[model samples]
Target: MTITKKTVIVTGAGGGMGRATVEHLLEAGANVVGCDLNIAALAELEENPRFKAMKADLLNEAAVQHIFAQTKSEFGSIDGLANVHGIAQHATPIEDCSLAEYRKIIDVNMTSIFLTCREAAAYMKEQGSGKIVNIGSVSTTRPRPGLQAYVASKGAVESFTKALALELAPYQVNANVLHPGPADTSMLGEFTAVGSSVDDTKKEVFESSVPLGKLLQPEDIAKSVKYLLSDAAEMITGAVLHVDGGRNI
Candidate 1:
């Protein structure tokens, strides 16, 4: 499926999955605007004529609005939004987790998507057509201990995406969520419990949990995003696509 002239905005563009999605979209001949807190990582993508890299804190409402406004002004229309920006919570029991830590995870993972989706929905509704793909965690379905905050945040994302899908269907806009398994990304280290060995956790826990016997790569999730954003998935909305190496099963 070719999205030759489509315009898509991807958050967390500097990170692994985000970068892969941006690259894949560019390869498909789409105009892509990628935003992330780490602007330096987006430099290589800037060399592409069809790619625009923006440095913005997604939690800031003003910054989120600015990105969407700039995209509309530059591209004249927004065809899709891929909410790939999110944070993981370190493994800790709910009682031991601090309020600040919990709130931060919720804000980054859930609220950020809300901000972007709200803006995208308004634009898409006006145009009467659009696509939205939100990145959720496989943990939502297969819970891991000591990750209460993180799991809860992703659960909110799944529910919110479904609500958006139903509400926006009349306008021909589609909303869906992608639940990824244990992805082998830098962020994987961040999910380990305090003082736990990241490498050991990867081998003994994460990798072992996947029935496929390997962790997911960034491109694995990107390919799924490509299909969801393409015409091939026009009938798929409010669906949770688990690209998780059978982890959900």
Candidate 2:
């Protein structure tokens, strides 16, 4: 799938999956505008002429709006969006999970996408075509214990993306969800239970859950993102594409 001359906005571009997606899109000749709170991580891609790094808080409405505006101003048009910014829920039973913690996860994982997608939809509607790929989690299908908050947020992402697909189809804008399995990113360690050993949980719990017997790499998810954002997936809106290694089965 090729995205030559396309302008795509990638949120959480500082993170493992987001960075990989930005790189892949850049390699495909897309004008990539990467946004993340951690500007330092985005700096790594500054050397690429096709890549533009914007440090912005996804949760902030103004920042999100500014990202879309700046991206359009820079690239002349917005062709696609990859909503990859999200946070993992720490393993905690419902009784121990605070309302604040739950809302934080929802805000980051779900609400941020809402803000970004809304902005992109406006721009794309005017342009008459666009593609949007929201990153979800395999846990939305194969739920694990103590991830209630995270799973709920991902579930919302899937539903929301589907809704967008239907709403935007007439406008020629496509929306879809990409559910990745347990990825071997630095954030993986943050999902460990309070009293659990991070290493042990990774090996015995996370890794073992994937039938493929290994963690999904960042590039694996990136490849799927590339397809979803390309012309090859033009008819793939309202779909949930799982990049998981049989984990949902």
Candidate 3:
């Protein structure tokens, strides 16, 4: 089966990769539901009849619940969900990290995912099948400095995806993690920039580390997320698909 005619929800729909994923999903003829804290970006997507926009903070269970309610109310049932909402750290050493700040990151990046999965799983369980493509990062598998909270949360995302897949597999609800390399995303400005300026120094290091010798683009990630959500990946559950340009190699 193709993605066309299916209904999908994308979190963090306001940003770079999130917007790209929404666009690709639309092109595939899927009914798309986009949610973001940025009301303006969500408004832009509402212009398309195939696209529905909802303002939500995934960290808020009520807000996320409303997103599902809106989707069900408007598009019937959801066929897929892409958990893409996340934030980057400013390279604060773990030694300097605050408990409150760490908790906030975990809440935003990990707890919110659990909330979405909880709601989506219920809907998909009733439908008997669905796809969940969660976005993780290479940092989860690879060591990165001064980003303890973000990295730990991403690692949890990877772990949670596997655990959820195990629980959802009996019903054919596929769950998987997409680990991206250092992509050219807005998040990278902090990871790759140097000494009070946006520099290529970090990018260079990342580029040299990757076997592909380059930074990944948002489209690369979008394409992978699309395919994972499609029927092509029907049998691929609980697997961590790496889109990090051979960085793990």
Q: Write the per-residue lDDT of candidate 1 for residues 45-109, one digit (tens) a residue.
A: 78887899999999999999999999999988899999998998888988999999899999999
TM-score of decoy 1: 0.99
Which is the winner by TM-score between candidate 2 and candidate 3? 2
Candidate 3 to native Cα RMSD, angstroms = 1.5
TM-score of 3: 0.95
TM-score of each: 0.99, 0.98, 0.95
- Score each candidate by Cα lDDT: 0.95, 0.93, 0.88
Cα RMSD of all models vs. native, in order, equals 0.7, 0.8, 1.5
Instruction: Between candidates 2 and 3, name the one with more favorable lDDT.
Output: 2
The 10-residue segment of model 2 with minimum total lDDT is 39-48
Give the distance in Å from residue 60's predicted Cα in candidate 1 to where it truly belongs: 1.0
- Write one digit per residue (lDDT tens) for candidate 3, span 92-182: 8677789998999888889999999999999999999999999998888886778889999999999999999999999889999999998
Which residue pairs in candidate 1 collide?
none
TM-score of 2: 0.98
Clashes of each: 0, 0, 0
Q: Residue 141: error of model 1 in Å?
A: 0.2
lDDT of 2 by residue, 1-249 (tens): 779999999998999999999999998999999999996887767998888999899989999999998888888999999999899988898999999999999999999999999999999999999999999999999898999999999999999999999999999999999999999998888888887898998999999999989999999999999999999998888999999999999
